[model samples]
Target: MTDVENVAEDVSLEGFNPFDPATQQCPHQYYAKMRETTPVFQVPGTDIYMVTRHDLVVPILRDTATFSSNFSTAGMSPDKELVEKMKEIMAEGWPPVPTMLTIDPPHHTRFRGTVATYFTPKTMATLREPVTEIVNRLIDELPADGEVFDAVTQLNVPVPIEAIATVLNVPVDMMADFKRWSDDFIAPIGSNPSDERRLEALRGTVEFQHYFAEQLERRRVEPIGDLMSDLVQSRIEADPGDAEKGLDVDDEGKRELTMSEMLSIVSQLLVAGNETTTKALTEGVRLLAEHPDTWAKLRADPAGYAPTVVEEVLRLSTPTQGMFRVVTADTEIDGVPVPKGARLVVMFAAANRDPEVFPDPDAFDPDREGLMKKHLAFGKGIHFCLGAPLSRLEMTIVFEQLGRRLESITLADDNEFMYFPSFMLRGLTGLNVSITRAA
Candidate 1:
């Protein structure tokens, strides 16, 4: 048996499955135990390793050279059947392309650099009025008092989709379609998805590819002031060329983004920008309802405390739970030997709650001291979320509007929080709340 296999035999995983429904609803208890006993554990039935401790996770994320994010399935069983199946399904979609999120350095830098300026704090700040407007408008459409509604459906999902759609320059009416496509695209990627689900995701991928390819063509012809136009028209020098040399001096030295490249990045933004923010908003509202004091404090001073509440919400209920990194070479994580090419799962959610980092880790304390942006909700290192500023803006504006508009809100007794059938994505499938208007 391999060293990893030997190590797995001695460790007691205790039936931990992040994809299980029970675990999704409440994984912190499991995370705490894993942190205590097996910080760098080999998952029982798989060759994948789970890095449960904060200290170990940070180094893995920071040192991308050693731990590559080329793709989650890098070190998977190289069975021909599975390989052929993946290719057959993926062929239905856009041609194979790599975005900033799924690639390592050099290539990652080039892709991310193409549009990083658009996501900068300064650039994102310019959209405050629009974001706030979108929030107020959604709140305006809320049900009258005595009528309850699902927060995830009415508020949480719509708000972020609309905001991101505007950035993508897509029609607001298409937000519903965007949500549907987003769900379908990510469904197959969830933990142990069945063949049927993979086909469904395949359909979504093909449809999305065709739709966005047309958008790229249009933007290339007539440049617009939106992100799509900016991306397609972006020109950066090729590797062998220096900035001192003209970007367009030679074909080898420079290139505009290809159709596949454009599709990859824009589609990535739609998926990443929509799902996590939607989940975060759902949990933020639920957390407030669970802890009335936090809600009361936010309603009392929306401006002063909304930011802190967002941070606390992010820490307590991180939307994207963890990410997989493939080990480039044989390495030791917190002293555990992880063989070369071994895939490691960085438990960002677990790290966020590490006792070493935050006191009373599991407690939802917005007022906790030293709470000045110290969480891995947006991840760390070079791959840190680019749309974080926009997400924060959306949530802050959302909470501020909720405070001003709703007199009171409480989760319905029958409301059983169901998470998406995903090990990576942490979010409520439903969140019904009884709300009152501020009359």
Candidate 2:
């Protein structure tokens, strides 16, 4: 079939509103249409451009000079009333600043360097034992055989929260609060949240800032050799010599992170550290239950199949659906004109399913060879996820444990899969499944 004939008849981009919750639920149809017809699409009546194709997204991610990561420069402001109210609440805490995801190049380089050593493979290797212990403990608390339970709550949620807590040297007892604060931090992203929801999110943000600010202070006075202690003591060196090379490293001089900067980075780690993994884990369970044949293979050799399963889950689920990038100057993508200050929503989820990149992209094939590393799920270029090692460790352990402990897995009778309403994130609100223990 020709490319035009290959397109689905029902797929129409007319009045496409990605922010709509319905569109957020099952966007594959629209994504396919975008990839085929208009790889670079502008949302109707908005300055936002959606970059859907895999080929197009990589260059945008690499060209930090043209497509900036500093979203504050995008000039997109929130509701005036909501902004005013949030300001009042946020004023009580340390002011928010762009630390990791929001800044580009030299600023990003220095900020990421401070905490980069903590998430290195060598560091993650030391965490395997403790993380495995946490996984087994959570698995031990699962419901009896043939009982229905929410995998998200029982397993997916706690595994990462507790693992990150262990890494940060915080009390695992406060995991419930940690999860809540993480949710609150990303509450307003990718949606037109109600005034009430926005205010609530602001209050929760202040609460988180206050709570972590104390922990950061404690680390300063009493160095405990934890991640927080490292953050408190880490310093960046001045490199004026590199400025002429377009490195932008000399502006801030040599310094430790400001209290506000530390809080911002910690908030990101708390949210990114757990939220993405939780979504991916929940989706993995759902996929295994839906595709029992794949689960059966995993059951046969849990450890052997786990690494691929992790990659497949990350690709298919793509917890972070897309991210915003502000255009630094007027540019054209694939011959289409894009104006300066226009925001680009680089669709990682859509790009993962680009048929050109992954043959039969929709299939849940764990054994799919060679393409595992090609998915942009962990992202591309300089802003690639820092917590990838830890996430992979947690997920690999969970799948292995699930395969070893469960004889059968299936969706609950009344279960209706529902994702959280956000364009930039894709995660099931809950996943209810009935399972039989391995004999």
Candidate 3:
């Protein structure tokens, strides 16, 4: 299909506006409607064409040129205000933008490559012993006091953050703050951020950025065993010494990542990489608790079922609800005309649950055979998550240990799940549960 031939015949047609929570709280029903009728309809409200079909979403996610991701939103406008909003989400004084996640190639290529060296799957695998050791020790420390604690507070919360913190060289005493900062940074509210959650998260972001700036300075003065130090040496600029606060010189003496970019990338990794995996573990246990038959199956063979559980959870409950893209020019997406500057929000969670794609989509079936790997939870193409393998490893170990720790598990009386209020993330603040060890 040619690019010009792709746009819908009528540009005036209105699309189903998905940004509204009414559309968000239950997006699947609406997606089904869109895919079934006028799959490429334009929305006068948003000035963008909605792409609901999985087939279309897969390609849109892959094509960065035709569909730019420089501006990230939930199918909203690619307006600078939205980009600025994304920056503010990271931390204030954060350069009116963060790092490579939202930028296009050339800049994104340079920035992403600098961070990739440290996060490769092989590098992550080498740490399994250490990660497993940490998991074992944490479970071993589980209260013998009969408190019947919150698994989230007890297990889910600590593992991933601790692992990444160990990488960042964050101090032990600051671990709680690390969790809090991640929470507040992404949370709709923030006691941890202080003030009215908005201002609080903003302030936390500034301090967070400032800390990385200082860390970058130290790394420049002395080489260290960390990604930050490695980033300090990339070939971004003609001279490493000439690298300024916001942009840096790479090993090749070209523009790589700056100090500000470093903070944004690190902060994004902390929140996105850590929280998603942690929630998957926490929710994995919750699902197991709800279905003992499944939990029993996992306990008996952690290697086999743990992986499927991750996929199942990802399909059923994606950590990221949607990812936005910018239309390069007037383009037809799934037969809809998206003008230049329009934002295309691809709803991963909804697409995963689309009845056309998954049979009985809501059912929690671990053996959800057939095309299961096609799920869009990790996203697609170059933007596919780098932490995927490590995330799989972490969950595998988690369930293996949880199987050994609890004799039996069930949701606590309260059922008080502090679900995040942000449109971007769908994890809870905490989920308390009761447990007993197997004899």
Candidate 4:
């Protein structure tokens, strides 16, 4: 047996709880074992199956018909009391509806289509100047050379939130609330919070919905050229055709989005637009701080190497680690039978580290062969991340700017390097770094 297989064999899967805080801290060993022995692993005492191998993950992601993205059917039962309380709170605002992430093809296509134009590579490229300005401004605010600063709060968090705010034409002054709302949106899925905490988050969600509803109304009456205006003005075909056809918005079935649908889409855009990107930025800094040699290489040629660094960081960090998918029909992943109604944790982070695909997968190697297209960090198939282009652009620019401005980035003496407690999301809670300004 190879060394990886040997290592995999040493780690037992018995009583392995993916949701455990310990597992969340360092899941790589468990993932390695799963990938090698049981690529389709069922979390003990649960109906959820985690798909680990890259080859298996790709097919599962592609076969959206069999593996549905509609997570409502995933058998996740939250606290009844909490649900009732949240429903009561949510009643004050627009009804919550499934938009991009939750719904399947035809509906997903419709929701994704309306805003797709704004996130395309060309459109994202247009924001390069503003994004660069945001990055530099944040860097300027960092403490003087050789001082310890919390990169997570000072730089990583603000950069993406501000950039996304710029895109959505939302006021950056409301950034704290924006971050809180974003956290609330993913609270149930990402952080397995307490009933009280969950209720608090729901209240925040209601506030978010109300705030965006007003924004949508303003955009409707007077269409500004921002993303919100585009979303408000854009019409979709009334008859959302089959998934295969993919978003056929002809004049025949043209209609504006309902208030609920508009709210849902905007909520998704806000949460997804900033949250994952924030995590990616945090992870990138952590990775750089850990590997001075890699940082040195990146500093040597910021423009040429920043993109590669971004991909490597994405591959290794994998901010949005795993996305939940439900089995529509009875299916078998790599001969492991998964019953209908079973929930599948499509492990993108694990897949990125699959040795069969990405050799020496754990190492931060920007020069890895086929590094650009191989990593599933942005995910694969139709339900791929909509904000991927924007995320990439932000990372590329931030890293380049860091490379130019900072002489060296080293972990602070007091750095704990702890990640946020989330089974689905992997991001450092904070990263304290000491930097020397480049001459």
Top-lDDT candidate index:
2
- The local distance difference test score of each candidate is 0.80, 0.87, 0.67, 0.83
Whichever of 1 and 4 has more lDDT, that candidate is: 4
Ranking by lDDT: 2, 4, 1, 3
- Tens-place lDDT per residue, model 1, 53-170, is 8888888899998999987552223356666776787787668577688998888888898878878888778888888989888888888876779999899999889989878889
How close to the true structure is residue 408 of candidate 1, measured as C-alpha lDDT?
85
- Distance from true location, Cα of 107 in model 2, Å: 0.6
Tell me the lDDT of model 2 at 419. Answer: 81
Score residue 322 of candidate 3 by CA lDDT.
64
| Candidate 2 global CA lDDT score | 0.87
Write candidate 3's Cα lDDT for 269-334 as tens digits. 778657888777776777788888888887787667777777887776677766767888887775
Please list all clashing residue pairs in model 4, or write none if there are none: 238-253
Per-residue C-alpha lDDT of model 2 across residues 38-72, encoded as one tens digit per residue: 99999999999999999999999999999999996
* TM-scores for every candidate against the unseen true structure: 0.91, 0.94, 0.82, 0.94
Residue 282 local lDDT, model 2:
92
Ranking by TM-score: 2, 4, 1, 3
Q: Cα RMSDs of all predictions?
A: 5.4, 4.2, 7.1, 3.9
lDDT, residue 339, candidate 1: 91
Per-residue lDDT tens digits for candidate 4, residues 152-256, read 889888888998898888999999999999988777775567788777988898899889989989998999887788887877767645233454455566767
